[model samples]
Structure formats: structure tokens, C-alpha cells
Target: MTDFKYETVLSEIVEDGVRCITLNRPDRLNAMNRGLIDDVARAFEDANADQKTRAIIFTGAGKAFCAGDDRREHVHPTCEEEARDLVLAIQRSTYAIVLNHKPVVGAINGWAVGGGFEWAINCDFPIWGESARGFFPEVSLNLFVTGGVSSLLPVLVGLNTAREMLFLGERYDATQLQAMGVAWKTVSDPELMGTARSTARRLADLPPLSVRAMKRVLNATALTDLRRAMDLETEATIAGFMDPETTRRLKDF
Candidate 1:
């Protein structure tokens, strides 16, 4: 929690040792630009390594938790090689949270669409606003899943449910996800940050060693080699991006 400044993310460590990082592109609904994605991954890595950071909270500055990648960022990669590298890097952004030692909480204030949905679900626990909704629009957009979601999501909500999410690209509200056990809690829009902060504080107050150990054990059992899955997903995603129809579709969107 040293003095870190990022162009698209804001980080703050509370007195209680909870580090809150806000995705700062409100006008774009916190869309994942290349800069924002890298900033997010770096922020989580730094917070995890910091001894003073007991727990981390991730939220957006405005209405949406994230709206997935900016169209420009997606269109920027000039060739298959560059697109592959870019997709892998984007996939790693969400892994920065799941692979971290300490607990990560997502404060989902609004839309978490496409890659945004991947980001929220990868958090150790997510507290979402009543207005918050998430969806995997990848299939429709000719994109593949990232964030190790294909492997991790099946473990959370079962194979069929995960398929329904990915294949059908359905939008899920806070209540539906809470019912499916994907969301830890869902509160009113105004109460979202407060509830997440309170939960993060409770976690930060716990024994740091025990908390870290618990998260490690959980990852060992349930989140093993998440990076590998992300790599595979990245390959598929880049292929999709390179498809001419997908390029046309993205441009139209």
C-alpha cells in the first residue's frame, strides 16, 4: 500500500488494513481498456504482496462494475500474434484476484457484462447491488470465455448452469446469482459499497495468517492452475477476434 498512482484505477488502504481499489473509468462504465486491465492486475498483485493489506475490495467509481473491454482496446491489436498476446494479458487481469493470497471482495454496483462478469465472479466473494446485473455476451459477440471461467464457473454453479450462462449468454441479476450461490450477498444500490466495506473490514480484522492459509487451501482444491485455463481461453478468444464476422459484429456494436 505504498503511494501508488494509476491512470485508470485508484487504490486506498484503510486504517483497518482493507485495500479498496476503484476502477476509475466511469464515463465508459469502467470498461476494460488495456491500461485499466493492466492497472487492475498490478493493483491486486501489489495489495496481495503488501503485509499491511489483510483483505482487498474491488469496485468501480460509477454505475457499472465493468462493461468488459472497450471496443477500441479490442480492435487495437493489429495481428493474430498481437491479438493472442493481448487476449492472454486481458485474461490474466481477473486471475490477479483469484490467484492472490488474501481474500478479494467484489462490490458490484451495476452492470458486469462480458469480461466484467468474469471479473466479478472470480472474486472470492461478491456483494452486489440490487441493480447490478451480469452476463456472458461472449457467444453472441463471437468471443470465447476468459478469466478461467469455463473451469471455475462449472465448480461454482454446476456444468449445465455454466453452459447456460456461456452458451446462451443470459443476463443474471443479483437475486438470481445469489440464489445460484454465485453472489455472496445482494443489497440495495445505495447500500452496495457500505455492505462490501463492512464485509471487507470483518475479513481484514481476522487473523492474517489463518485467512491467507484458508484462501491458499481453497485455491489448491478449487482453483488449481487457473493460469493454464486462462491461456487456453485466450487462444480461443483471439481466434474469435480474428474472425472477419466478429470484427464486423464488434464494429457494429
Candidate 2:
């Protein structure tokens, strides 16, 4: 197979038609900075276009799957315009994952918070390690999750559980998430990637058109229509990020 044109993050095609995409900024705990955000979206888009790539497995390079938006990069210009642009970028990056047709799996090795949690939610399945943790702490930051979590969380763990997590900003360990039906499975930290890869390979072995059609059907149930849902999500995300309270909390972070 041809090599992937990767930069900012690392990506490679493994056996059994699995594409492994790793968030490479271990030094930052795999934080989603602006560059990594763009790269991740591009990686998924590329994988979607590649005929040989049947499934995608996403994971991080270090102690954490992703710590969320890098605090350093998020705290920018003390003005509204810059904040608007920042939010829009994040929304677009997130939309790429949600709209991708191929099966996507998240190998959560450690913490997945804020945007990181949203990223994981975008995946068709989330397989977590024993040490993995997931949380939506955006409420504490005066921000709401705009990364399709509002729609996805209820479906994963029920509306009551979703409200508790999003409204209270609580965090849950892999075991808890598994019990809540949010996680597909949990394995040892050392075996996280192996489990994810195996899952991806199994998925890739299935009939491609059937898999794609199933994904479309699943997504169809989530909204009045795909395009309408996307537009609503985009607008809500941009507005949430631009909220005065959210801006204040972001600056403080």
C-alpha cells in the first residue's frame, strides 16, 4: 500500500484494511490544538476517499487519548472576532468525523475530556483501556458541548445519564462508562490499540456497501435530516463558543 501523506499527526495503514490515525502531540498530552484539529479532519477525509481504507482506528500517542482543546491555543485574542473564528474551526473539524461514512473506532488510552470526549463520541464505537476516563467538563467552563454530543450522548447512555454528565460536568472511568453502556468494551492499557485494530479489521471484512448503508441509516435516525442537523449543530456550536460566559471561562483557563 502507498504511504499516507501525514503531518502534524501520524497515520499509517495496517493489515486487514485498517487505517490507524494517532494524535502525535504526546508532549501536550495529545491535546487538540488548531493544527492537530485540521490534520485530524484531513486524515479522516483522506481515509474516506481511499478505496483500500475500509475502517479507521483513532488513538493518541501518550498518556492521554486527548486532553481536549489545548488550553494554550484556546486562550486567544481578548476579542469576539478571534473567538468566533476559533469556534468555527473546531466545529468544522468535528463535523468531518460525524459525517464520515466509514466505521471509526476510538481507542481511548487515557483521559478524553471536553473536545476529546466529543471526538470519541463521533466514533461508531469507543473501546477504552482500563485506565481510560471520559468526561464532558465544558459545563464547568461555561461552555456546552457542541460537537454533536447533545444528540449522540442521549442515544449512547440515555437522556438521564446524558443530562447528568453534560449539566454537572462529571467524569467517569472506563468501568463506569462500560456499565452505563457508553463504551463498547474495555481492555488492558497495553492491549488498547490491539483491541481497536482487531475491531477495525473485523469491520473491514464486512460487505462495504452494507456497512456504509447501515451507517447512513443510523445517522438518519439522529436528526430531522442530515443537512439540517449539521447546520443546527454548527450554529449552536458557534454560538456557545461566543457566549460571554464561555469566553470568560476560556480566558480564565
Candidate 3:
């Protein structure tokens, strides 16, 4: 199969039937902007369509995995409509990752916060480096998690742990994340990508049809219907963004 095409924020390659999509915004800690989100969605779509690609791995380019949304772009007018739009965009990005039929593993090397944390949570498996840290610090900025965090977090780490993470807005190291059931395993920083690639290759070696079917079955319980979940998440996200309080908080940040 042909390799996927990507731009500044994304890099794609197919190796051993495993497609690797790397977030390439190292200068900004690989923070998600409009370009990154667009590229990521396209990359996932492309990977899913490639018959040779049985699994996918997502990682970052710099010292950090993703620091969430670009703060520079987020500083804007405290308008309800604009906030709603921002939320919808975020939901779309998250849904893209979750709905992709191929198995996805998030190789978190450094820090993943806010929307980044939400993105990692949506992946089928989360493999972290010893230095990796994850958290939902949106509350610290007076903003709430919008990218299916309400649904995914509770399922991944339970209601009480989710509440603590959301409420405290503190970072959790890889060890803590593993304890909370959010991280599948922690590897040394140098082995992070290699470990993830090996894991993806192993998945790729499985019967593709059966693997896909299994994923569908597993997702059915967490996500009743992929399309329906996406729709609801999109609506809730937009509403949250359009809220007066949220608008004000976003503007202040």
C-alpha cells in the first residue's frame, strides 16, 4: 500500500504493516493548533483506508507529547459563539482518533495535558515513557475538558479518580498513571518508540478482520454507537464552549 501523505504537523510511514503517525511540532511542545488538528484527522483517515496498515501508533516529535491546544490561538474574544466553535473543533479531533477502525496506541513520551490528555485517553492503548506525565489541567485555567473526557475518563480511571484528576488539575507521572489504569506500561525514554512500534507490529500480525471485529466489540460497551457518541460529544463540547463562564475563562487564558 502507498504511504500516507501529511504536512508540517504530521508525519506518516507504513512499516511492518503498522502505520506510525508522528506529531511534528517540536518547537511548541507539539501543541495542537488548527493545522495540527487538520493534519491529524487526515492522517487517521488515510491510515484507516490503507489495506496494508493493520495498526497505528501516534507519538510526538519534541520533549513533550502534546501540551494541549496552542495558548496563543486560544486567547480571544469572550464570545459564546466562538467558544462553541472551538469546542466543536476539539470534539471532531478526538472523535477522529476514537472512530478509526485500526487499533491505535499512544506513545506518550513527555507531558500530555488538557486536550492532549483527552486525545491519549481515546486511544486503544497508552504506552508511556518514564518521564511521561498526563493530566487534565483544564480546570486550572477555569476551563473544563471537552473531548469526551466526561465519558472516557470515568471509564478508564473510575469516577473518583477522574474527579480527583479533573478537580486538582495536577500532573500524574507514568507510574501514577499505570496505577490508575490509564497507562498500559511504562518504558525507558529511549525505548518508548521502539516499544510502541513492536507492540503495533504484534497487533498487525493478528488476523486483521478479527482484530477489527474485536475492537468494535470492545468499543461498543464504552461507546454505545460511534456515530452517536461523536454527535453527542460534539454537541456537548460546543455547548461548553458557548457557555458564558467558559467564554470568559478562555478569554482570560
Question: Which candidate leads in lDDT?
Answer: 1
Better of 2 and 3 by lDDT: 2
Model 1 earns a TM-score of 0.94
Per-model TM against the reference? 0.94, 0.90, 0.88
Q: State the lDDT of candidate 3 residue by residue for 1-253, as single tens digits.
A: 4465666455455577887888888888888787777777777777788787789898888898888878876544356676566666667666667766799988998989787888778778889999999877676655567667777777788989889998898789999998999898888999999899889989999998898888878877776655555566566555655567765666675
Off by over 4 Å in 1: none
lDDT of 1 at 65: 93
Q: Is candidate 1 or candidate 3 better by lDDT?
A: 1
Candidate 2 local lDDT, 144-230, one digit each (tens): 576667777887889899999998988899999899988889899989888998899999999999999888788877643545544
* CA deviation > 4 Å runs, candidate 2: 75-81, 222-230
Residue 110 of model 2: what lDDT?
A: 88
lDDT assessment of candidate 1: 0.85
Instruction: Give the range of the ten consecutive residues with the poorest summed lDDT in model 3.
Output: 1-10
Per-residue CA lDDT of candidate 1, range 1-253, in tens? 5356899999888656888989999999999888888898888888888888898888998889999878756555568998887776776677678876889989998899888888888888899899999998888878798988988888889989999999998888999999887898999998888888889999998998899899888887887767678778888888887788887777787
Candidate 3 clash pair list: none
